[model samples]
Target: MTTDTLVMPSVTAPPHSHRLRQVLHDSGYALLSLPVGVLFFVVVVTGLAAGIGTVVIWVGLAVLALTLLAARGSATLERAQLPTVLGRPVPRPAYLPGEGGPVRRLLTPLRDPQSWLDALHAVLRLPLAVLAFSVTVTFWAIALGGITYGLWDWALPQEGNEDLFELLGFDGGTSLRIVGYTLIGLLAAAVLPFAVRAVAVLQAQLGRVLLTSRAATQAELGRLSRGRDAAVAAEAVALRRLERDIHDGPQQHLVRLGMDLSRAQRQLDRDPSAARTTLAGAGVLAREALEELRALSRGIAPPVLADRGLAAVLAALAARSPVPVELAVDLPGERLAPATENTAYFVVSEALANVAKHSGADVCRVEVGLVGDVLRVVVEDDGTGGAVLVPGHGLAGLADRLRAVDGVLTVDNPRGGPTRTVAELPWA
Candidate 1:
């Protein structure tokens, strides 16, 4: 009878034991903030005083601008430091580019609102840093001193040690006093991690409110406004183009077919053979009209795209392209949102159309895939590439279409070779 046995390799502590590491990180941040905060506060305050005091002399303007620039730099450093404590990125504020010559550029920072905000943050941080540093250092020192009381208490002149212990209601004995101090030390040590974390979080939140970019909402609103305008103009243009196509193609064919049938009816009794020929011509015109209508419908929303998904639609596109196209598509089994699929399809269609019309390339490669939560489509061609997104151009229209859906279209076409057009849409 043999006993079943199991053996496992030795391992260190579990990954959740981050209390010590967190405490050390917070403590280090607090200590570093003190001197850095002091330095920023001094520089900013001095610069402001000097700039205002000497403003009539014109030297103040330069000093003020330089001070704001320095404040921006300090805010940037704070943003860089926040991610470790806050666990997320803080985007930098956007600043307007300075126009004109050397002196205008020098005074650019003074006109910016974000630069002033940064200066305010730099000035305010000094007091917050002082509080964090004092609290953190004092807690650590008390905790360590209490924990080591047993080892070092003997070195002290021990005349009144018993009275000290009795005052705390512990027995008047050396062992009791040592035990009490160790317990108090253990309690402080237990609270140290939490205290440091609280201070760090407070400082990080303050920095986030003051130093980080507040323009994201404004930027998004502007994008949506532009996108709405573009969408309206594009829709109007598309409607006009559709009307023109119908007028040129199917509408003319139908009119000619009607005329031919009328002629056929008139000649039926007088000349049966002539009527037959006219009827035949009418039938040909009818079929051509039907074909033109089908093409127009496909341009609007292809039957294949509705039936299958983007994969089948793209396969049909590849089959019909003027030049040889290498198609690669990796999509989810289920279909994407209708708008996303439609936008992606049109982007590819327009890009390929541009290639066929403008780019003199022998072969093109089209790649479509779901990259994370984004629908990405890339159309690349080896051609004489000098593509620019001029207004009213196909690429510009594509950009407008993409912008309407918060998608992006990028064209990478340099002179003397390959052009790569990429369109990305959010999958959601």
Candidate 2:
């Protein structure tokens, strides 16, 4: 035989209107749900005691080389049951501390607050959900049955009407009918809705208490994570820049210098004048290598960019580039963090370089302005199509550099050309 399981859709009131009413109703119901609260409190406190005791027992057993499977198994079930009833997501119990030895498992429970809370939540959930669910269900059943019975009695208008209302545990004749009908209306309009809302609010509160971090703590963690991401990106860019500088600059020059020396040796036997010319070429190559190394060092976190700030550095880079650059800078010299300023300078420099080398654009525009807490830099070029993220290129390095400072780089290279690279760096 084939069986089909029916899935019921969730019924929740609208967030603004119905939800708000539900919240208020739940707040008032919290006190009325006193028995449930007390029961939950007892269960939670007891579970905490048991869990702590169990950990101690496990440690003692581990010292004797006795199996601890039973203790661990029990704790696992206790914690798992919490999420089922409370409707809050809680983690399951993993291996206790000190599985490697007696000291670890014993100390593990002490170190973790969540472990203790999990045990406590599990122990308390059953009592709380049971008491609260029971009271809510009972009240609803009475209100519904009373109203329904009374209405049937009133409509029938016979000797059996009195018996039906009485059986429903209501007052005599008209009085019974009125009370039952009134209760039905009130339950439908207020009581039932309030009960469901109260349960949800309580569940949310418990979930937050046992699961999610506090608002302030979460905000702090988010900030730290962003800062870390930026730092990592910056380091990555620095490494790439070092690699490129070595490959294109000093390394290539040194190889050529070596070849020139070999040529000089060959010429020295036949023609001394030719040998002198080769030596002169090697000298020139050595000087070129030194200049390339210096340039690479400067790119690896330049002191000039740090001391003078971003605007000056960018202006210098733009003035020196092969392409003509029009810089419109509006940032206050003292308002930027050293990191933020350095990253911005690189973004503009890299973008302009791309324009000169690849974009085939004649003229480029660079603008730096502060918008509230963030510094916005725009580099636009009327160049050929296709500016994409190519690994190891200036554009990719620029993106990494900006990200290191909690900044973002957006390259809008539409099909028709005219690529716009906008970099936003957050002020410290």
Candidate 3:
């Protein structure tokens, strides 16, 4: 037998490599800030100047409006460039659209608060950008020049000039000059990345604060609120359903078993044969209740899931299923988040249970895999199909549970043949 080993490139970057990459990005961004800042400042200042100077005529109103629009455009460009420094995209905010005539719409930028903020950012950023550019460039120059001082020292005019060490008044020589400057170079090099990143962040942060959209933020908050409410509702519904199932299934079975055992004890003294029959019935009821309780426990956080993860637990579930199940599941090597694994487990468990109870199919097929940033689970069966998501029903409960985790469940059950149920959850 021959063995083939295929090597794959590692995806996780080393700490030092990541640090170097970030430093390069910060350095590039910092170096570019001065020119970008200058362009913004000059444009904004000139436009405002012309607009204010022409205020005597109605033409000044149009100038001021156009200037505000230009400021907004500059702000947009600045925001787009920030992700290279911040390592994330800035949210774009919604602007108010004016109703009615052409002039009101043209002047809409003046009325918006975000537009004003953007314009303010354009004006204020120039000073910070200048500071950042000076510090970053000075530090880089010192580090480079000092480190390479020895290589270029002979070319400089040595007759009438004092080197850095000589100017300090201690001493002056070729050896001293090289060693002293090299030390300074090493020190500056050590702090160069941090210094550059700090200044770049200062400049980029202003744009983020001014340019981030309020509407986008509010939409995100609303999504989280809805998820919270769904979680609460789903938990309540699950608890109630569990209580109902216990009451109607194993709870009633145990009660009947107790009554049968009591009857058997009472009959034992008078009629031995009658007592034996009652005892046998009680034994059957006891076994049934035990099995039902075991099934309920399987739906919960089983130890196998924590030890062996979703794949193993799913294999066990498929083995126990009444309908023959063909499971094809591909998962990552590491364990998923606890809540995600639990939700996925229950989705499959409930889905298989439905296939057995309602589908009445000879065979069922289950496919599960991570599709990009989503965990998708699909169960299909060749059975008589009439499934629906009615309120307070199993399918409805599944829908609610999926929604709690920002997941969705859909079923395609036609009149007479096959049924397919698909559930997709975020890869949280």
lDDT by candidate, in order shown:
0.82, 0.64, 0.81
The C-alpha stretches of model 3 lying farther than 4 A from their native spots are: 1-14, 49-57, 97-100, 213-216, 221-357, 361-428
What's model 1's TM-score? 0.62
Instruction: State how far residue 228 of model 2 sits from its true place (Å).
Output: 3.8
Every model's TM-score? 0.62, 0.58, 0.55
Against the true structure, candidate 2 reaches a TM-score of 0.58
lDDT of 1 by residue, 205-292 (tens): 6777776646554466678899899887667666776799899999999999989999999999999999999999998999999998
Model 2 is weakest, by summed lDDT over 10 consecutive residues, at 1-10
Question: For candidate 3, what is the lDDT?
Answer: 0.81
Clashes of 1: 0
In the range 73-103, model 3's lDDT, one tens digit per residue, is: 8887877777777777767777777877998
Candidate 3 residue pairs that clash: 93-213
Model with the higher TM-score, candidate 1 or 3? 1
Native-to-model Cα distance after best TM-score fit, residue 394 in candidate 3, in Å: 8.8
